[model samples]
Target: MAQASAPSGLRFHSQIDYAGTMKISSHAVARMLGAWQAGPGPAHQRLSDRLRLLVLDGRLPLGAALPSERDLATALGTSRTTVGAAYRTLVEHGYLATRARARATVRLPHATPSERPAGTESATINLSFAAPPAPVEILHAAYAAALEQLPRYFERHGYDRYGTAELREAVADWYRRRGLPTAPDHIMITSGAQHALGLLARTLLSPRDKVLIDHPTYPHAIRTFAEARARLLPVAVGTCGWDTAQLQAAGRAAQLAYLIPDFHNPTGMCMSASVRRRLRLACPTIIDETMTDLALDGARPEPCAVHMPTAVSVGSVSKSIWGGLRTGWIRATPSLLERVEQARPATDLGTPVVEQLATAVLLNGRQTERPDALQHLRSHRDALTEALAEYLPDVHAPRPAGGVTLWGMFPEPVSSRLAAIAPDYGVTIAAGPRFGVGGAFERHIRLPYTLPSSQLTEAIRRLAQARLALTQGATGTHTPAPVA
Candidate 1:
């Protein structure tokens, strides 16, 4: 029998009614920290810090069982003593609790032992977003390079609505390398990709203008278009990919279209070159390449504009490098960008000079976390798949070639119910309807492999518990948004 493990070491049930014990795979842990080279601290301290950061960031997640020291040392290519010391350090700091034969479990360092609520436990794990934490070394290096370039801009007032010259040029160079030749004038930087989308929506859409989008698309894109008062013409993308004929069929009627052709968000499916070539949409389409750098497969697809030149591309470092960077760009003709620049200030003045500078360093230097992140992503993906197989065998989750999420299909409309009861089991999963318009895809759920293998395993276990509870007649399937 298994028992639900709480972050604060709270045990409510004497015997586990369902979900078995979880043991994290060593490969999964290694994948979570991709290209994590030796940092400034001692070996054990560095390992401890890295693990601690993962825990604090909700990546390792509380109550997940860790692999044995010997197993982890072998996986990390380090000595057992070093791994043992790291575990001891984590234990001392309250990040982990270990027994003799049992694997160590993650926990938080609390000033006081908090009391559990009368009927439920506090929510711990977050599986809503699919993106991973940034590589610490690469981020620091980029910022350091940005600081070296910051003095030149300090003399100016720094209100660069069209974007700084360095960032614009870097964005153009990125496109050129991706097989879409772009000039500096064609690139306009914004706070991030979402900001770029908002700017485009504001500039391009009139009230009730029909805009084509994927039915189960990025939630924020739907919100952006809704705020712009555009009538969305959504084309559904499935396990295979987007229906190109259907997309073109819809695009012909719309004023504008939004697409994520390369490594799509929730599905992780890459659009075929054939689809790209045949996407002869009459309207101006926007291709989001935020996840282009997160290709788990060896092949990286080219920009959509390469096949459909009329299509514009929007990109950012959020999916690839770090979400906090808030640096992204729009690739379009100078004339269109002029219109976008004019409407930019309604939202904000401009992208921060420092962030733009840092992004430039990463882009121009051709620095990416993909090579390091790919193996890790693949491992985590496999881990998630294995856990799902073990915990909820009925749910079918496809393994995508790239991108962050696994679109799982449940036999019943349990997505919303699962989300509602997940907190009681100490996990939070995004309901399928969150990604769809009109609360569709109730039987589907987007599972992110961003968390560590151990966390993924435990989260799946919790999900299974919630599903079982639903059958046992839990509360109404109305999950409130997490109070962040």
Candidate 2:
């Protein structure tokens, strides 16, 4: 395998004619870094750190020509002097070489802590993760009630990784109430949906085994599969629902298919009963039901797993109740259950006993519903959709039957550009590209209606202002209009 390339300061490409021969540019090098922005640091330090990560991460392979100083400056929106300083810093750090040809080339130094890419520190409104705030009082009460039951298990081994049999039974019963016949023997409690996915990846996938995913799917699942060395094949999801033809094609080519059959992330599209049946016939599936219970505007529930007997159903209280619960489970066949049980310890030993017990308490009716939270989320969703219709009229804001996000499509391919600018107005939003594989869906943005109505209104006003400013070629600071 070829070594990875080095990182550079800029996000765009720059072509340079080298030694009166072949042309080289930073595009390939920056592409290797996955187009990450330099994290928060002093301007030059951030630039240098990003460059080093690209090199160390094998994103910029050896002998690749760095962008010219002028091109680097333009790409980063900084002065050539600043780009020069950053290049000098990297050179001193042994990450690049100033060759006789006068074009800088990438080189790798010994791996060190500085080699890691700096964490994302962008201040944009982070609608990227479709998370809602926890109901703190309700969660606290649930925990208290759980502690009261804790002493009963004190004499026994307090830590059970496969989850307490009680919680497993509760999960099974939870599914049964949802119209699926699940049993405790078929459930494996996990830390969260992501953890459960990771366990499944490790257990079921081998290097380069094809895993089918939807075009605009949950991104973290893609990462999990990629880390497990599985090749991802994305099938397009239609405006109404999953594309059955593409799904069947992918299933024929892949070993597994990961789906969000209930209120999909970003799109908010749910799979119909017919399509779910087709998917079941196609392959063994992993159906994520995190947003299944989060219906808004009196939307009816449509459970996909109910139509697919062989499906592995993944659910969590994160979307329905509180993200702080840190509890989720996989409902599958008893055979798959045994396999997951054997693989669970290698990831986390098991989900936390305390959190599981608290979740069980909530499941068992110890806590009351917070009407205010649901009402707030619903109002926010409505306000956001109305705002989008009024301001971004050209954009397609599909009113999802339920769920907390509004997926809007712009007339232009500048969703990433908008994401880069949203932070200035104190509102964070996710670009459509972040939700899909490769660089598709650049015209989209996912806005969550999980914030309080007042904040949601203010956020929409800021977004309108940002959209106007972007169209007019303004960057950096702008006075935002007051939320009406």
Candidate 3:
């Protein structure tokens, strides 16, 4: 790592060279500190806990360098001594390593607060996901607010499978706000986006039917359609973005199409306006906008459903708000929704009313990604790209404008092998084949920028190590998912 002059009036230095050794810009650190913007108790203790959680959650990969105390303090808008205290606390707990005139690096402490202090222990970092941490304060507020409205639902059977009326209206409003006029009658709330897909697949798909999907698509969706006994039809989505003509052509022979036009997961690729307009599919379509609200740059694009009013749109707060919300909706014709409602009872009676109430509050709140969150995701994305550039220069990773994950392409079919060996290097990765069918996508893997920038850097460094270890005949043993 190389040092650079401190920000004027600041005493600590910044690490400028980031290619070989892991380093994250101060800007990104602030974003990852979401709810910790102001601690409920002492600043240092809260900061220490937050950093520890990042490491435990695999958001901060071990071995990544931490920004200088002064640099982090400036970014947090706090005093330098406050950051110094936090770093010292981490060092004491075995979460960080520091020496004279050197940057602090991350490590998993042998003992956590729950465990008695003892010898340092090693752990494997889970990289199989990219979900965001909940905005604790905001979520608590919503739930507290939900309590007030809970009494009104006491009169209903609470087994209404179409979802609570309040949430349905709220979801419709969400679509309208997105520039697509929607009716509550056309919306049916489900457990989550996956649940929404499962229900739709059950209602709309017949055995042996063909379902069109992006070549490299959401892994869960592939499983969902397959479970319903549908054959998969894939249209390639590549670096140049979607090929509208190819999709429309694939649509003709398909029973239905599932697409992620905005903030496409795994790829983080967005379709062009002309392409969106030119697309005309022959079958009913299911368009997923679960990642719509995560745009880091450019205005929120119009939903692909806008171009085809008959398209069934699926969305959730998983990305924009929190994945644990367990609330999602499907937007389509009232008659179609009516049929879905009839089939849904076979799976479950209905969604939970309290969960619906909280999501109603979230959806109707007209909330956008917090300024801190967008900045945080952008910073993490840049950090991930930079890390790959340094450690795996041969791999190609495109910088995305929005969403949490990045799709990385390697020169060979090494993704499965990488996943198998990553645990040995103290990291775990979702292989390319996990995202595709028939052993396809062997040259690709998805990298999410949802982790802290420092963790993103560290995780990449661990990945580089895993690659080398594999070459040296390293074997792996899986470990537990960290919880703090």
What's the ranking of the predictions by lDDT, best on top?
1, 3, 2
> Where does candidate 1 stray beyond 4 Å?
1-123, 476-484
Q: Model 2: how far is 398 from its true place, Å?
A: 0.3
Give each model's clash number: 0, 15, 2
Name every residue pair that clashes in candidate 3. Answer: 60-455, 61-455
- Alpha carbon deviation, residue 24, candidate 1 (Å): 47
Range of the 10 consecutive residues with the lowest summed lDDT in candidate 2: 1-10
Encode model 3's per-residue lDDT on 352-430: one tens digit a residue.
Answer: 8888999998777755457787888888888999999999999998877688889999986666667655665666778
Winner by lDDT: 1
State every prediction's TM-score relative to the real structure: 0.74, 0.74, 0.74
CA lDDT of 196 in candidate 3? 94
Candidate 3 at residue 322, lDDT?
88
lDDT of each: 0.77, 0.68, 0.76
List model 1 lDDT by residue over 1-484, tens digit each.
Answer: 1111111211111121235544566765764444344545578877876576556534455677788899889999989998999899999988899888788988887644433224336456788767788889988999999899899998899998989999999989888887777889999999899999999999999977888877577878877886676767767786568777777777778889999887787788888888887877999999998888888876788788888888778989887778889999999988899999899889899999989999999988777544767788889999999999999999988888888888899998666657756766777777775675543566888888987898898889878877887788763222344310
lDDT of 1 at 78: 89
Structural RMSD, model 3? 19.5
Q: What lDDT tens digits, residue by residue, belong to model 2 across residues 63-159?
A: 6678888877775567888788889998987777897646788776554432111222323344545678877877888889878888888898666
